[model samples]
Every structure is written in C-alpha cells, then in structure tokens.
Target chain A: MKKMMYISAVTEALAEEMERDESVFVIGEDVDIDGGVWNETAGLLERFGAKRVVGTPISEGAFTGLAAGAALTGLRPVVEFMYGDFIHVAMDQVANQIAKARLMFGGQAKMPVVIRLCACGAGTREGAQHSQFLESWFAHLPGFVVVAPSNAADGKGLMKSAIRSDLPVVFVESRQIYYDIQDVPEGEYTVPIGKAEILRPGEQVTLLSFGYACEKARQAAEMVKDKVDVEVIDLRTLKPLDTETIFKSVEKTGRLIVAHDSPAMCSIGAEVVRRVVAERFDYLDAPPVVVASKDVPIPFNDELEDYTVLSVQDIVDEIMKISVGII
Target chain B: MKKSSVASPSAEYFYRWMLAIRHSEQKLKELYIDHKIKGALHLSIGQEAVPVGVCAALSDGDKVFSTHRSHGHYIAKTHDIEGIMAELLGRATGCSNGYGGSMHLYNYEKGFLGGNGIVGGGISLALGAAFSAFYQNNGQIGVTFFGDGAANQGILHETLNLASLLKVPFLAVCENNGVAATTPVEKSTSETDRTKLAKAYKISSLSADGSDVEAVYAAASKAVAHLRAGKGPFLLNLRTCRWEPHCGIIKDTRDQKMLDDWRTNHDPLNVIAGRYPELLSSELRAEIGREVDARIEAAVAEAMTAPAPELAEYKRNFGV
Candidate 1:
C-alpha cells in the first residue's frame, strides 16, 4: 500500500535519507519541538539529536539561508518552510545566493541545497494570505529545479533525489495530499527528477497535471473515458519538465489539456501551452486547452474555497467542452 | 575576558586603513557625482574601527559577514582595496566577477565570506558558516557586521537566539551609527540599550564607542577571545557617527550642526592616533596618502582594464 499524504511521503523520504547519508538533516521552525505544523515531521526529531533536528526561530530567511550556507560548505541541509507563502521573505537567499551561487562561481561550488515547502492553494479555509500556487514562480527561475510530487512513492523518491542531486532543488508538497494514502514500497526507491510518469494511457486526448491536480486529473480522465479516451501524465517535476514526453504524447493524440491548482494566468499551464504552440503547433488538430483555478483570492469559507478550487468534474467538463467544441 | 589596547603599530595601521577607506569613498563620491557609477553604494565612513579592530584580531581561519554598507569590512578582511574598487566600479575583474557589485564582495580564500547586499541578511548566513567551522572542527570564528538599521530586523534577533542557544562560535557586531536610513535610532526604538537585547539571548553583549580605535579594538579583542574559547556567540554594539551624510550627495538636512560637530570632534582615526605623542603627523600623513592613492589607483586601473564576464558564462551549469 502507498501512503496518502504528501507530508507522510516526505517524512518517509527524510527518515530513509538521514539513515543513508550521515550529514543529511532537516532544519526549520517548529520541526523538532512541535513535529512541524502539519504533523509531517513527526518523530524524526526524537530519532535525530538537537544538533541534527534543529528547531530554528521565526526567521525563515535565516534557517533557509543557513541551510543553503551549510550545503555549500559541507553538510546536506534539507530546509523546510512551513508555507510556500513565506518563501518571499527568503527569495534573495533562494534566488541570488543559493540558486545562482554554483553557476555564478563558474561551477566552483556545488550548491547541494534542497529547499522544501508545503506548496499549493488546496482548499482548507486558510484564506487568501496563506494560500497561493507558487510552483510556476520558481519554475520560471533559471538554475532552480522545481518539483511537485503527487503520490506517496514519488514524495520519498523525489526528496532522496533532491538531496543527492548536485543542483539546487525546490521540493514543493501539496498540503491537500499529506493524509491521502497510496501503497508505497517499503524499501528505498529513487525517482529521477525531470521524468514525467504516464498514469493512464489513452489515445483521444492528453491531460497534463501534477501535485494535487493529479488526483483530479485521474478522476476526470476516468469519468470522461466513455465520451473520449484520456491520457493523463503527471509532471512530477516542473523544471527539467519531461517536455519530450509531453510533446511525444501531443504528437500521438494531436490534442492536449494542461491543468494545475495554481492561478491560471502566467502559470505552468500557460507556459506549457505557449511551448506547445511554439514547438509542437503542427501536431495539434485544435487549440490545446487548460483547466485551472480562477485568478482570484483563495477564500476562507470552506464552500467558497471549494468552489474556487479545482474538482475532478471540472477537469472532465473542461476537456469535454474542448473536445466536443461546446465552448 | 578583559579589554586590552592594540599594539602601537596596529593602532597606526588602523588609522591608515581608515584613511584608505575614506580616500576610496572620496574617489567614488566623485564618480557618483559624475554619473559613472550605477546602483546604490553604502559607504562606511565613520565605522572603520569595527572592521580594522576585528580583522586585526582574527586568524586566517576566521570568516567575515558584512551588511549593505560593507566596503570597510571587505577591505579590513581582505585588505584588497583594489578588488573592492573594481567591484564598486562593476568591472569584470572585480570580486564576484562584477556579478555582485558594491554590496556583494566575496573572497572565500581570504575568509571574506561575502559583503552581503541585504541588511541583516548575513547574520544567519554567518551562523551557518560558524556551524560549518564547528562541524569541520576547524575552530573558525565567523563574524557578521550589520548596521544600526539591521538591529531592528526581527530575523537578526532570532539568529542571535539560535546562535546563543546552540552555542555557535560566532560574533555579531551592530554598527549603531545612530541611524537606520534617514530615521535616527531615537525614533526607531525606545530601548537604547541594544546590548541588553543580545543578553536576553544568553549571549555576552556589550556596547562600545565605535569611533575611538582603542575602545573598538579592546571590545573586539574580548569578543573574539570569548568566541575562540568555545564560549559561543557574542554581540558587540558599536556606537559611531556616519562622518558623511550616509553617502555622498546628501538630500536630508535634519541636524546639520550636530552632524558637523560629530565630523569635527569624532575624527575616529585621529581620536586614537592623536593621543599617541610617539607618532609624527607629516610622516604618517604622507605614508597614508601614498598607500591610499596607490591602492585606489591600482583598483580603478584593474577594474577599468579587466574584461567583462562573457554573456555565455551564466548559461552553463556544473556538470556532475
């Protein structure tokens, strides 16, 4: 059986990596003392000492910057930000220093820095300030390897790869998938970043999704199967995106639909669509579609938030509309 | 454990370093006035003693972290005024290869970790460097220099707390030049005693007169000793005056008389050097001017002549 929540997968990944690499450790706020805000980092602190399982102050920029500094110097630091929103405070460290350090120095530095964040605006009534789909923002940045894992298996596998990878990696987790259970093999299994997984293969239409949107895409693909054949591809990693696979699928089916939980405007979906239009324009029989959340504030009320967020049916309906030419 | 005076030569050297920095700034101010320089450059005119005193005491293994107004720290740490000049000029031969201009000077071999552009940004970064020094068991002491404005940054206090709690072998210096930008310290906070704040983190903290070379040197010596003895993080608040109105081409004129008075009375280099009857003025001034001019000239020439970083350079990444 696979674990459900993205947090649990992250926990399993951290545990396994810490066991493997002596220098690997997690440093962040409320991580050791409180087992993390979402209860993802539970019990790892007890296993690791105060030295390894560092409980830092409210200074997100410091600990994150500290992790980058440590990674550059010697140790492999897996720094966690409680929310993706707080990354803005440490963007200078993340962008200018950490991301560009290795490349800026003409490869003299490795920058084995793995920055993790509880990402995506999944509806839990957290309101506007707390919720934002910031994956695309990082994906746009050069030298930043952006990862958005969907299932439990990918979480541990991708994280392990992130720690081992020489480049700077941003391992973002979907808050909505932390508790969701899926069967993950009980041993060490590494997932290669930049490889997109084909969840379900079909011929009529191709659906690109990742993170929380994977669940919706799967459901939508299933429901619209009788009407149109749906091929769902989970882009586990956004940067170093499996563009070859995405374009190949587009070549086969001559149709594509991109969906993500982030705001639709200037998002990954938009970028993907632009790339498809520019590179693979001749392969498409019709304009490639996108199913994403509205460009507005994520609400505090549960129902309103749910209304704002994507659903399996929404993906299905949007794809069907494009396929059927109802819109 | 206690304050001690720097050697007579060391005190004189401090004066020389201060003069060099001043002349460098004067040269740059002309450039800024001439519209040759781009970007905001924060010059450390009065806060010279902190870097000179601290760098004089630290061994080669010790690391330095500095704030936006960081030319003095970089010069004090590396003593390469030429690299600093090329850097401020944004020349290709400059440290960081002209990628990081005035505020982001770096020379890891010299243990000049960086001249950080962000205010109070380098504090935690220094803590990590200190942690590396600890983990590597190199006994390397990390010192991060911040402006009085950076004291108000909440992250700095947090890092101080962590550094103290973990007993990280590091030192934090707050160059309290009475102002954070245009706002004076009196307007910034009611609690004038910043040393008390560091003490709250259980780290040994003290306020010292930043202008006098002896006073700053004595405080830095004690602070560095405590850190070297495995006593963990230490804080030193330096109360100095910005001899220039923040930087060249000043707009704000709040207290011109007070500022003028400070510039006249608190000549930091002179304050310590003047008290020494053993030193002669003409000889020292001649030597100082000669060295300063040589440094400034070499740095500018190197920067101006150096090739710019190729546009193709940033496109490549490290291959595994």
Candidate 2:
C-alpha cells in the first residue's frame, strides 16, 4: 500500500489509465500546462504530450461537447471542469449532448467520457459559485454515472473504473479533501461502480453519506459510539446508487440518517431517505432524518458558510434523536 | 465561370443524391400531413445542395455531424433512406432503432455521427472527431453542418476559436438558409456575413451559392483540401433558402413573393439540372426520378411494416 493524497490519487489514476489505454486523453481548461487548478492532472502534459493533454479555451460548452465528440469517435476523453459550478455554463452539453448521446442514439455509441469536477463545498469560503456540491443535479439525469469518492483509495480505484466504463461518468472530487492522505493499494485495482462501502459497521442506526461528508459521518459515528451504535456507509457511486447496500443496512438498523454537503431539498440524501421509506417502511423504528446543507446558496462569509453547511454535530444530533429509546 | 461541356459522373451522382433528398423530403411532408409520421419534422427542402455538395467532397472515412434539419445530410452521407424512414416511423429497424426519430439519425460505420436536435450542438463534437483523427495521424476529417439559426449560438464561435488554435482537421459548413425559423439573419446578428466570424478566428473561409450543387461542391472541395493538408479549420458559408417551416408541415410566415422567387429561381435541383441539361436530359431525368420514387416507396414499405421497438429493448437501451 502506498500513502497518497486524494488529489494525487486522482492524478495517479489518470496517469495509469493513460499509460494503459492509447485512446485515453485529458482535455479541459488549464489541464495541460497548468495541470488543472487543483493540480489533479499534474504531470499528464509531459507524459502524454500535447496531443493527449489538451488545454482548451475557457469555453466549457465547446470543450465539453468536443470531449463528447472525441468520445463518440475512438478516443476516451477525461474532461476537467475547474469547478463543479462551471458545469452550469455547459449544462446543455453535459445534460443533453453527452449524457443523452448513447441512449438517444439507440446504444450505437459508447460514451466512455469521464467529467472530473473539483466540487468545493462550504468551508472553502469561495462563495455560492465555487462552493456548491451539485451531484444531485447530475444524479437526476438518466445516462450519467455519478461518483463521489471520499478518500484516496476509493478516489484512485473508482476513477479507474469510471475511465474504463462504457457510459459517461460524472466524477466529483471534493477540494475539501484534496490533501487528505490515505493508503491506496499498490499498482492496479478498481473499486467497482454502483457499490456502497461500509466504512464502519454497527447495529443501532445507519449514517449514510458521500464525498467529504463521509469524513464528517465517520467523525459523528466515532463521537456517538459509546451511546449509540452507528453504521456508516460511504456511497461512492451516487447514480445507479448502491441501493441494495443501503436497503440492507437500513433493514438491519431499522433507523437511518442520510447526510451530504448539498442542499436538503432534491439532494442525494432525499433520494436515499425516500427509497428507504418506500421500501423498508415496516423496518423503521423512528422517522428517518436527512442531515444536509440548507436550501440557500453557500455563503461567502466563514460563519454563514459554516452555518449553511452540514456539520458533524448535526449528524450526532440526528443519531441521538433517532436513538431516543435506545440511548 | 468555367463550365464543363458534359457533366462528370460525380456531378451526375450529386444530381441523383439531391433528387433523392428532395423526393424523400416531399414524401415525409405528405406522410406528416396524412398523420403517418408523428412528432417533429424539419425538412431541408430547398437546401439539399449544401449537404450533397459538402458530403461529395468528404472521403469515406471522414465523419459528418449534422443539425436538426438533417434528412438531407443523412441521405447524402449514408444513402440509407430505409434507415432514416424507419427511424422517423419509430421502428426497430431504424438507424437509431426507433429511439431517435426525425431529429436523431446515427450510422457510425459510415462516419455519420448522428444529427443533433440542439442548434449548435454538433459544432464542437465535429471538432473532437477532427482532434481524434489528428491525434491518431489518420487521414480523416470531421465536417459539421449547421444552419443560420445555429450560427448565432456561442458554441459555434467557441468551437471555431478552439478548432483554429488546435489546428485540427475540421470543416464547419454553415448552411445559411436566409432565416432561422421565423427570425431573419439580419434581425439576429448585425454582421450577417458569417464568413467574417471564421476569418476573425484566423481560419480560412469561403462563401458558396447553396442553391448550386456544383458551386457548393467546388467550395467544399477547397475547404476539405485545406483541412486534409493540415491547414487547420475551414468554414464554408453556403447561402441557401429554407422552403419549409422550422418544424412540421406548418405554413411559412415569410413573404410569399420571396419564397416564390427562391422556389422559381434558386431551387437546388433546377439549378443543377439547368446547368447540366445534357447530362440530366429528359430521358435520364425521367429514369432517375423513377428510380428515386421506387427507392422511397421501398423505404416507406419497409418502415410501415417494421415492428415498433419493444419495451424490453427500450429498458435495455435506457440502462446502457
């Protein structure tokens, strides 16, 4: 096992995939020389050369569409959106063109394109534009494979799987955990898409989350360990959701608390809770709770941003509330 | 202008392809009116020369990305009338297997990257294809066809700049069909000369009479040559007219006199046939017309009899 930062894991995965596949190429703003704003694609330009490591004009719609086109042909393109919020600028290309290409074309085309978004949330204090986790928006789309890995190991493994998949993937990497280090397995291995990882196993209640929020869920689980036994499941893949894992956990625990950095309304947490309620209604010991960011835009102010974002305490409170009789 | 005494076989082929598109569009219009074909239908009735001419200059390995008014482009590129007909009829045998109707038609083997419903959607897609060709050191180019409506979209300018900067083997063919649906080019953009947009990006461009198939072919050939020679991107503004409404068989709100003038003087088939009267003689014209009609009839028969896509197939595609 090799210890690496979450950002380095992403870069390593890209380098490894490019080395393995001749068709794999990197394209987007500041990706070539700049090595991406977060340096997630560092060393790719030198290794792959100018042809593969393409630095596009700051035209999100054009480059994103271009990546779709490249993917349509023989090339496998990994598009880096400097920030996840920039996806809105190229919404038509991302939501309509790339995502809908395969299904709309009757599966004749394989959209093996990976869109890497450096999704920053709350604590960054980059204001409403830069700090927003919009995974739910893409998760709602039909033809997208949404992945949000919390740590280095899963980051490397899942990215490899995403690049190798035939379908278009929205790979969301949180800037909050860019430097977070973890032991990634040596050499090649892929964390399969559409599977949830049980980070910590317990029996009292289930604490489900993804991306950076998984860190907070683990912390919350640790804090409430003595009082309430909590099972934490990091949903590595958001779309084609690992519902089987979630259902099994909810069925065991009989209580659930979904968490994420995105807004509570129309969030991944909402979907998780909705599914659990619809499927495992009889298993419920108490009403489920979704611990998520407020419905307002993430604030620029530090205090306001902290208030707007989901906190570890919030998860703890939800666990305590649901564990009323048990505790 | 230098004129040939006898039209070459290619010219004759262009003439036949243009006629096929014209007849197929007319058949589609009739089917739509009779409630045979449902959903949206955008026909390139008078603008057949643009696709036929541009496609004539492209090699077999080269790719073509087209806009919503794509019947002409699809028919010209693949000559798969039955595939397109079946697609519009939502049959399992359709080019896109009934998932894509009149707006979306794909044939990857033939290098037709399918038609996009969005106005300027295919511009950058073609650029990517060109980029791929350039990367692989393959002698292939990608040609994207858009109309006046899509010319104003930001993606077009963005793609032009990128294509020029990257020096990819890309061709942007703007079929300037006077008006974009109901909005005239004059009303949409102050600078109506679309070639200027390409020139601003330092990309070479040319303007051709879209009504004349030979003229379009000549200009497109120059553009394709420039692209194949690693001369970066080139844009061809084919000045043409839209005979039908933007979508469906609706009455055109344009000046009747203008439409009549275009139909009378600038009809692509008439312009080509008038130029090559001997090559497309009355006997040959009748024979070609009979052949085109028979093909259209066969395509319609196939589409009419083909089965609608099963729900299980749709479910499978949805997952895929």
Candidate 3:
C-alpha cells in the first residue's frame, strides 16, 4: 500500500483504466488541456492524447448525450459534470436518454458510461447553486448504479469497477476530501459496487454513511469508543444498496443512526430508515435515528453553511444518544 | 423542377423507396382509421427524398440518429419494411421487442442508432456516436435527422459548436419541412434560412431542395466527401414538405391550397414519377407497390399474432 491524496487516486484510476482498455475515454468541460476543473484529470491528455481526453463546451446536455451515444456505439465514456449541482442541466440526457436506453431498447444496449460528479454540500464557500449533494436523484433512477467513495482506496477501486461495469454508474466523488491523504493499494485493484465496508467493530450503535461524510462517521465512532462500542459502515454503493451488510450490522448492534450531507427529506437516510423499520424492525432496540443536513438550501456564509449541514460532532452526539439506551 | 437527366442505381432505388414510404404512410393512415393500430404516429409522407438521399451516400457501417418521424430513415437505412411495420404494430419480434413503438426504433446491427421523441435530442446523441466513430478509428461516420423545428433548440447550437471544435466526422441533416408540429418556422424562428446558423459555429453548411431527390442526393454526396476528409461537421438543410400531421391519423389542418400545391408540384414521389414516367411506368409502379404491400401485410399479420414480451424480460430491462 502507498499513501496518496484522494485527487491522486482519481487521476491514477483514470490513467490505469485508460491504459488497460483502449476503449475508455474522458469527456467533459475543462478536462483536456485544463486537466479538469479540480485537476482530477491532470496528465490524462498528455498520457492519452487529445483523442482519449476531450474538453467539451459548457453544454452539459450535449456532452452527456454524446457520452451516452458513445457508450452505445462502443467506447466507454467517463463524463464529468464539473459540479454536482450542474447535473440538473443534464437531467434530460441522464434521466430520459441514458437511464432508459438499456430497458427501452429491450436489453440490447449496455450503457457502459461513468459519470464522475464532484458532489456534497457545506465547507465549500461556493454557495447554493454550486454546492449540492444530489446523489439521491441518481440513486432513484432505474438502470443506474450509484457509488460514492469516501477515502482514496475506495475512490480508486470503485472508479475502476465503475468503468468496467456493463451498466451506467454515477460515481459521486467528494470535493471536501480531494486533498486528504489515505493509504491506497498500489497497482490494480477494484472494490465491488454493491458492498459496504465495516470500518469499526462494535455492539452498541451502528453508524451508516457514504462518501466524504463517511469519514466523519468513522471519526465520531472513534471519539466515543471509550464510552460506547460504535460500528461504522461505509456504504460505498448507494443503489443496489448493500442491504445485507446494513441488516447484519443493525442486528448485532440493535441501534442505528444514518448520516449524510444531503438534506434529510427524501434522502438516502430516509430510504435506509424505511427499509430497516419495515424489514429489520425486530432487530432495533429503539427507533432508528438520522443525522443529516437540514432541508434548506446551503447558505453562502461559511458559518451558516456549517450549521446547515452535518458534522463529526453531530454523528458523535447521535451515537452517544443511541449508545446510552442500547447498553 | 429540374430532374437528373442521367438514370443511375440511386435513381431507380430512390423512386422505389419514395413509393414505398408514401404507400406505407397511406397504409398506416388506413390502419389508424380502421382502429387497427394505436398510439402517436409521425408520417414522413412528402419528405421521403431527404432520408433516401442522405442514406444513399452512407455506408452500411455509418450510424444514423433520427427524430420521431423515423420510419423513412429506418427503412432507408435497413430496407427492412417488415421489421419496421412489425415495430409500428408493437410485435414481440419488433426491432425493440415491442418495447419501443413509433418514436423508438433502433437497429444497431444495421447502424441505425434509432430515434428519440424529444425535439433536438438526437443531435447530441449523434455527435457522441460520431465521437465513437472517431475514437474507434473504424472510418465510420454519424448522421442525425431532425426537422426545422428542432433546429431552434439550444442543444442543436451547442452540438454544432462542439462538432466544429472537435473536428469529428459527423453530418447534421435538417429536414426543414417549414413546420414544427403546427407552428411554422417563420413564426417560431427568426432566421428561416436555417443553414445560415451553421456559419456562426464556423461549420460548413449546404442548402438542398428536399423535394428534388436528385438535388438532395447530390448535396449528400458532397457532405459524405467533406466528412470523409476529416473536415469536421457539415450541416445540410433539406427544405421539404410534410404531407401528414405532425402526429396521429389527423390530416394536416394547415393551408389547404399550400398543401395541395406541394402535393402537386413538390411531392418527392410525384416529382420522380413526373420526371421519369418511363422508369416508373404503370407496370413497374404496380409491382413495387404490391411488393411493399405484401411486406407490410406479412409484418402486420406476424405482429398481430406475436405474443407480448415476457414480464421477466421487461423487469430485467427496467432494472428494478
């Protein structure tokens, strides 16, 4: 294993995938010469030339549609929406065209397209329009496998797996942890899409989360380790959700708290809580708690943004509350 | 009304195709009125020359993206009238296995990438297909067929700009039928001369008489050459006329005189039949018409008897 930044892990995955398969190409705004808006695709153009790495106009609809057509034709296209909020602009292509192509065509089409979205709200001063964690929209879409990688290792692994998959995948990466260093396996490896990783083994409370917020849950678990045995689960895949892992953890701990950066209503947390209540009601010691952002647009002010979204302290408090009753 | 003095392979086949499409639309109209076929239908009755001319220049490997009025485009590309009729009838053996009706006809094996219901939606998809052709280094090109109404969509301009910038092998064909559904181009768009819009993106553009099969074929030939030479994207504006309503069995409610004038003077079938009566003699026309009728009937019979798709298959594609 080698230590690397989350951004480096992303770039490394692109390079490795492009090298492994000639059909893989990257298309998005500022991806070619500009090396992506956040430099997540740096050195790709130099390594693969202009044919493999193409910079497109700011028209998300066109590029996203183009990526879909490219995927249908033969090439595996990894398209990037510079910001997660911009996914709204490309919704027609994503929801109407690409998402329905496989089923609408009677399974003749395998849409091997990966959409890399820089997602998550709070901590970024980019305000309401640019900062929004909208993975719920894609997770709800049919014919789409949504995955969010929290650390460098899963970031690289999930990206590789996403590129290789025969179905459409929305690989949601976080802007908040782009520079955070983590130990990633050197060379080639892939983490499966529909599986969750158990970050800590405990019996008192179960904390469930994905993406950059998963780090906060793990940290929160560590903070209350002396007083409570907290089990942290990183739900790497949102769709085809790793319900087996979630159910098993809930059964062991008998308490659950779901955390995410997106607003609480109609979010991933709601789905998790609903499923646990419906199927795993016998396993719960108390009603499942949810730690999520308030259902309000993220504010521009740093302090207001902090208040609007979840934090490590929020997860720690939720776990502590659940632990007191469970024990 | 200039006609091609010389009769070649395309001339003979073009006349037959125009006749086939015209007769097929007439059959569809009859079926809808008889309550045999259901759902929205966009007939390319008077605009057969545009697809025939454009597809004449395309190789078997080239991909074609289409709009809702896609029967002519699919027939022109694949020459599978039976399959198309079965698809329109929503059969188990249809191109999309009865899942896609009129607006969603796809035959990837024959290089017909199929049609989308949204206006101007196919443009970007076609551009992406062209990008794939370029990426694969397989010498394949992408073609998109949208009407004049679709030209006004913002995505069309965006696609045009990017196609020019990328220098990919693509052709964006605009079937300027002077109407977008019921709205005339003059009412919805400022620049009625739609080909001029390509100039803004610095892409090569051409204007063709869509009613004149010879003219459209000539323009398409030049476009194929331009694209083959790696000259980026080319926009072809085929100013044709739509004989039927934008959708359904409803006859056009537009100006009767204008429709009559076009049917008389600008109908591609009439133009070809009038220009070369000897080539399309009564006997020859009757034979082709019977062939098309038989094909459509066989397809309809098969489709009417074919069972609906299995629930398991539907669920699999639904990915639920």
Candidate achieving the largest lDDT: 2
Q: Residue B242 in model 3: shift from native, Å? A: 1.2
Candidate with the greatest DockQ versus the true structure? 2
Window of ten residues with lowest summed lDDT in model 1 chain A: A101-110
Write model 2 residue lDDT over A44-111, tens digit each, in one string.
88888998899888999989988999899988999988888988999888988998898788889988
Q: Candidate 2 clash total?
A: 0
If both were scored by DockQ, which would come out higher, candidate 1 or candidate 3? 3
**Per-residue C-alpha lDDT of model 2 across residues B25-118, encoded as one tens digit per residue:** 9999899998899988998899989888888887667899998889999998899999999999889999998889888899998889989999
TM-score of 1: 0.90
**Local distance difference test, per candidate?**
0.79, 0.89, 0.86
Q: Cα miss at B221, model 3 (Å)?
A: 0.9
Candidates' chain B TM-scores in the order shown:
0.92, 0.95, 0.94
- List clash counts for every candidate, in order: 14, 0, 0
Candidate 2, position B234, lDDT: 95
* Deviating ranges (above 4 Å) for candidate 3: B1-8, B250-252, B316-319
Q: Clashing residue pairs, candidate 3?
A: none
Q: Global CA lDDT of candidate 2, please?
A: 0.89
**Candidate 1 per-residue C-alpha lDDT over A1-327 given as tens digits, one digit per residue, 9 for 90 to 100:** 554566777788888888888778888878887788888788898887777788877777778777766775678888888888888888878877787765444345567878888755668788887787678878777778999898888988899899998888998888878877777867688899999999999887889999989989999988877888889999999998789999999998888999989877888898889999999999998888888887788888888888888778789877887787522
- Candidate 2's docking class is medium
Give all TM-scores, in the order shown: 0.90, 0.98, 0.96
Query: What docking class should model 3 receive?
Result: medium
